[model samples]
Target: MSRYEVDKALWDVYRDASAAKQYRRDPVGFLAPRDLSDEEREALAARDVRRLVALGSHPFLTYNFALRLAGGFSMPFVQDYVGQLQGLVVGDITT
Candidate 1:
């Protein structure tokens, strides 16, 4: 019910600093207005990249979101993103 919304949230989290701040401050509040199912809402609130991918969110979006969560794109944080994505099983990102 919320694949597109999930991707949109990820894109916002990646591109908009204000959105990122709001998301970091309160993810459930940030997502409250979106057309998200409970599963999608919880995954976004949790910043669960693996769950996002499994739900068909684009890898680029999830990767960038993970980078932001790790506090930037340094190699160490990128590695942490990679770790967060471990065991990912991407089915189809096309919504």
Candidate 2:
């Protein structure tokens, strides 16, 4: 129920190189200190963008974070990220 924390986590990686490196090194560990629900932690670790969206994280941040996870706007990753978000509509984003 904490979209603020969830989106902060996404933004951490999306905007900071150290955070992104930490994420690549240890996804769970990187998020361990964040005030996120277990479900949120699992979703982020698993890179489950759809689940994150459903959890109310900002879709734009989620998409950008996915690109970071895919090593910066590269192939296959972009396609995979796109697939996860296919046929989608952004829902309530209030945090």
Which residue runs does candidate 1 get wrong by more than 4 Å?
A: none
What are the models' TM-scores?
Answer: 0.89, 0.88
Instruction: Report lDDT (CA) for all predictions.
Output: 0.85, 0.89
Please give, for residues 10-70, the per-residue lDDT of candidate 2 as tens digits.
Answer: 9999999999999989998999888999999999999899999988899889988988777
Candidate 1 local lDDT, 1-95, one digit each (tens): 56778889999999998999999999999999999999999989998877888878899888888777667879887777778778776776665
Question: Ten residues in a row with the worst lDDT in model 2?
Answer: 69-78
Model 1 root mean square deviation, Cα atoms: 1.4
Candidate 2 global Cα RMSD: 1.6
